[model samples]
Target chain A: MNVAVCVKQIPDSEPPALDPQHHTLVRDGKLVMDESDSFGVEMGLQLVEAAGGGEVVLVSMAPCGETRGLRTALATGAAKAILVSDPVLAGSDALGTAKVLAAVIRRLGPDLVLAGTESTDGYTGTTPVQVAELLGWPSVSFARHVEISHRALRVKRQTETGYEEVTCPLPAVVTVTAGVVEPRYPSFKGLAAAKSKPVEELTVVELGLDPSQVGFSGARQQVISVRAVKAREAGEIVVDAGEAHERVISFLEQLKIL
Target chain B: MDKTWVLAEQRDGTPAGIVLELVTAARGFGSVVEAVTWGPGGAGAAAVLGRYGVTKLYNLGDIGESLPGPKVAAAIAAQLAAESRPDAILIGATHDGRDIAARLSARLDLPVLANVVGMDASGGRLTSEHSIFGGSTVVRAEFTGAVPGLFIVQAKSFAAEAAEAAEQRSLEIVEVEVPDTGPSDAARVVTRHEEEHSGPKLDEATVVVSGGRGLGSPGNYALITELAQLLNGAPGASRAVVDAGWAPYAFQVGQTGKTVKPVVYIACGISGATLHVVGMRAAQYIIAVNKDREAPIFAIADLGVVGDVTKVIPRLIEAIRARR
Candidate 1:
């Protein structure tokens, strides 16, 4: 019942700053665990707690051999972590990421894997299923509720209109949505213990991946140009002055919505 | 001309609105447009699809209780393997659509350009435009490898338009076979639950009133509901309030939630983080009501009110009721 959770260490800013020249996200700062992954970590911890005889492991890919974010995730009770860090891995696309993560999961041989439905920064929302595809494992995305029953995973998967109760066997991947579970705050004791937690670092080569098939060289898509979205001109700003509602109602009247 | 394919979805024989939108987008490629669909609704949707310029409809037939991701992807991949490959595959970024696209990408070892808001096909190459950073920036990208690039397009990115009467032709129906890929396609939907809801669907509402953390307490959310009901609009919540458990995730309007493009969107006490703004910034008109005049939500708002939502909402509700 070993569980592997995919966590992303993202730049610690909302609307992350992009490199002026490269037009890419600036990742050379203090990175933190993406808030989105916190839910996956919490879900993995609870799943292990319910299983009663397993450990939750963290898997990540970050630059500069960083483990700061992984330590935070470990502080929440994951046993250890495996980080794939290499300069060659920079500029990797979603499929490249899925390849690295799938390789790591295959090596660990976890019975079940968990990930956020999408990273707050990237929001591609395709990596977990791609990882499942590469691993030849079943995947259930947008799981609002997940429970293990006799080596089978029962999940409440969200849909466009409602939700569906779905199930799959072990050795599967499940991507949890944000707000699906309340993430626990890291205790002082747990934070102190995280320093001693074992973290194994690997490179693309170590994972038996060719450098040519990763990063910019392996990227299948190229950004042609980047530009700011056309700005909408500010219409009107009115203070409450005890009659702001009147203004809103009048404005809606103009639009005929009222 | 390039061959463009759209993956369509339908429920109970009714095509999802985005499917028609994808069909319209596929036609924009100025290529031979085709469609692939699954479930019992596939056959039922062909006539409407034909009118929308889909010359051929590849039906995967009924997939039973099996989750449609792997099965549909396998079926599409099988078609690609057996026949001439399409130059482009357009799929709506819906729940099952993402799954099928990802699986198909992995199966074919291809790349997917997701969150596409715009597309341009010039010189026989397809370039996709993605709206990012809360729709504040647009990035144009294209695939450097592989044919039939998979694209998961955002809903409502394009208008759904049917063909003219003179151009609507008889559609060709092709049955696709789903290859059994062992346990990888083992997930099954055992039951479905539809949460009780009333009023117009959130994304389809002419007017949308969304509440944020500024509403203070979960009980205060009643103001949002009351106001929305009075306006005949749908009530929405920011991710902050949804994450705080004050509202159902269904009410969430944000990057990870439902993208809403209403005629008018009223934000009550929402600070307007980029995550939440991305979902509603496309509204025809935005009005922000926040005590903090400097809130980001007000930056994009057509009308800005510097006031407390708890105080402003009740007053606004009364005014609307009086008008009625």
Candidate 2:
């Protein structure tokens, strides 16, 4: 019942400054773990704990400075952390990122892989499905709840209408929505224990991944440009000092509310 | 030059709303629009596509016997890749369409754009516009490789035109048996649950009435619904209301919820978070009603009524009914 959680280091949505010049996010040299990925990590931890024997591995692709996010995952409950970081990995979009993740999952040979439905920054919601395609595995996205039994994994997916329950065989990929579960914070003891855990660092070359196989160069899709949205104009407020009923009637008449 | 291809998603043998919208959006490009569908064997899904001005319709007969993401995507991609190399592809940004678009983009080695609100071809390149940062900003982009462009059109962004019903024409139905690249490990579809709501959907409605956290509790949702009914439109909610469990998540209009481009959007008891406003900024007209005159929603609202929703909504509903 081995499980792998693919995490990404994304720019915080509330960035100090947006790089308008480059039309890219400027982190001011600070990288934060995507909040959605935390749900995937928590799902992995829950599965490992329920299985009572398998391990939960945290996998990520980030720069050297991004190791702190991996460390934080380890502190939370992951058995170990694997970092696939290199200069070549920069500017990889969802598809390329999924390819790298699929390669790592193949190397680890896990029974199940879990990922967040979408990262907050990119918000593509495509990586997990793409990764599942690359790995030739079944993928269930927007899974709100999951139960892994001996032969199959039962899941509840949130749809526009209502919740859908589905059961798939083992060795599959599941992408969880934020509503899936509440992530746990790293405890004091867990933080100390995480220091002793092994952290394997792998470069693209070490993973035997050809430089041409991952990143922007390998990605099929490219973002040609990004522009800031136009600022909205302020509205005129009509404040009438009248009785509550009179004011309500007058406002409705003006707005054609009636 | 090879023409563009549009995947016209159909449910139960009829083209979905977004499919028509996709075709309408792609019509201005002036490329040969080939509509494709994967449905039950011998189903007349292809015949229906012709009404949408699809020059050619490819019905890859029921590849998976049921609508599964990978199976449908593989079948369509394999056919499109082998038969006609399209210069670009368009799909609706629905859950099912988005899944297939991602897989198709990966398989075809093309840049996949999602949530494109508008697209125009200029200087031999297609520039697609998308709303980012919860709709606060609009970004235009283009693909940069030999591969064809792939885009997922945002829902309700384009108005769907009813294609003229013409004489029945037979379309080529190519059946491509996708190789079992992987085991069938997906959870089987056991049952489906559909919510019953009257009136038009909020995203497509001409007028939308929405509630926010200012509506004290779930019980107050009736006021929002009454207003929507009076307007003969649809009801919507801000993320705060949905988060508060006063309304269903499907009714939420925000960064995580549905993006709507309606004619008139009225926000009642909403403070207007950027996330919420982004979803509705594309609306032709916006009106905000809140007790706090300085609520952020007022910044983007075309009209503002500074009043308490609890007092205003009931009176408005009564007055509208009285007029009738």
Candidate 3:
């Protein structure tokens, strides 16, 4: 009864600016675990706890072979961590990412896998399903609630109209939506334990996967260019110490449709 | 004319509104448009296909009950394998639609472009335009695969319209063998609990009034609800507010939420994170009220009011009441 929760290390969403000339995010400082994955971590911990004696494992692929993001998840009470880091893994497309993650997940042999609906930076929302496809397992996306019973996984999946109740056996992939649950904060004891939690690092070759098939070399899509946008200038802002609402009404009147 | 396909969904035994919208979008590529869906109960639902001028309807017809995602994708792959592939496949970016697209991409060894706002066919390839980084920018990409380019277009991008005259189209009613994939077969819908809701759906509202973290507390959301009611608008919440439990998921408006193109969108106490802008940037006119003039919402707003929502909202309501 082990659960593998996939987490991502992302540049702060509110960065002052990306590196101007490089067309890349400024990863110079701390790269935090995306808040998007917090639900998955929390759900994984709760499920493992409900299962009586299982462990929640953290899995991630970080740039510059980083582990700070993994440590962030570990601080939430995950038992261990696995990171796939290699220079060759840089600039991979969603498919290439699914390939690397699938290979690693296959090796871990977890009964259930959880991932965020999408990363804040890359919200493609395709990698988890691709991983499921690659593993030849079942997949459920947009999951709002999940429960494990009788070697099966049941979920409340969000849809456009409303939602539906769905279930699949163990060894399936479920992508959790944000705000599904209130993620627990890392306790002081949990933070201390995370410092020593076993982190196993791996490369493409170690996983018996071809380096050529794991990264930029194998990517089917590439970003042609990224340019900083000159956002629209701020409009007429009326600072109303007490009459701001009246000023807004007059402004709307000026538009001839007040 | 090249053949194009739409993966349609059904609502209350009729083609869903978004499905018709997608069919309208597919009309741009070529005249030969078709639709694929499940459920035998939707035979009359097949007539809505005719109204959209879908020449052919590929109905798996409920081979698999609720977990029809994998089976539908399998049926599509089987069709593509057995016959000439369609030039493009347009799918709604709903939860089930994404599941179908993902499984199809995996089965076909092709990349599915998700979150496309618009699309075109050029030189035998489908070019997709996607909004990225909170809709401040957009990127154009083309699928370089063989036939059957997969696109998951965002909802509300295209307006749904019925054809001038309902054209009687060819119907291809074929049942597919639901392959028994081993354990971990995509989960099945065992039970359902829909949040009881009433009011205009968020994306369909002409007037939307949204709140954000600036509302201060969950209790403060009462102001937003009352303001929206006074304005005759649907209530929306920034992702931050919804994430903080001040509002429910249905009230969220932002990236990864509903993309709304209302006639007038009023922001109450919203700081306008780029993510929220990405979702509501299509509004015809935006009026934002935030005490901080530096809030990014002002950058795109037509009129910006620097005042607290609690103060400004009640005053505006009074003004509207006295004037009306």
User: Which is the leading candidate under DockQ?
Assistant: 1
RMSD of each: 1.5, 3.3, 3.1
DockQ of each: 0.73, 0.50, 0.50
CA deviation > 4 Å runs, candidate 2: A13-22, A191-197, A220-229, A238-257, B40-48, B63-67, B162-181, B240-245, B290-294, B305-324
TM-score of chain B of each: 0.96, 0.88, 0.91
TM-score of each: 0.97, 0.89, 0.90
Q: How would the docking of model 2 be graded?
A: medium
Best by lDDT: 1
- DockQ score of candidate 1? 0.73
Q: Any idea what lDDT model 3 has?
A: 0.78
Worst 10 residues of 2 chain A by lDDT: A240-249
- In candidate 3, list every pair of residues with a backbone clash: A165-B189, A166-B188, A166-B189, A167-B187, A167-B188, B39-B62
For residues B1-324, what per-residue lDDT tens digits would candidate 2 score against the true structure?
A: 247778777767877777877776666676666777776632465665666667677666654423267776777666765765777788876666767777776666565777788888755577788777766677777776765677878777778774656632445555456645456335565555565489988777878899998887789999998889878788999876775667776788866677788777889999987668767888877878788988988888777778888877787677667868
Q: How well does candidate 1 score on lDDT at residue B48?
A: 92
What total of clashing residue pairs does each candidate reach? Answer: 0, 3, 6
Question: A1-258, model 2: which lDDT tens digit per residue?
Answer: 799999887765463344655354554366777877898999988988888878899888874546767777888989997888787876566777777788889999998999987777777778888877777777777787899998588887666656567777778888887757779999999999888898788888888788876665765454456667667787566653433445445544665644
What docking tier does model 3 reach?
medium
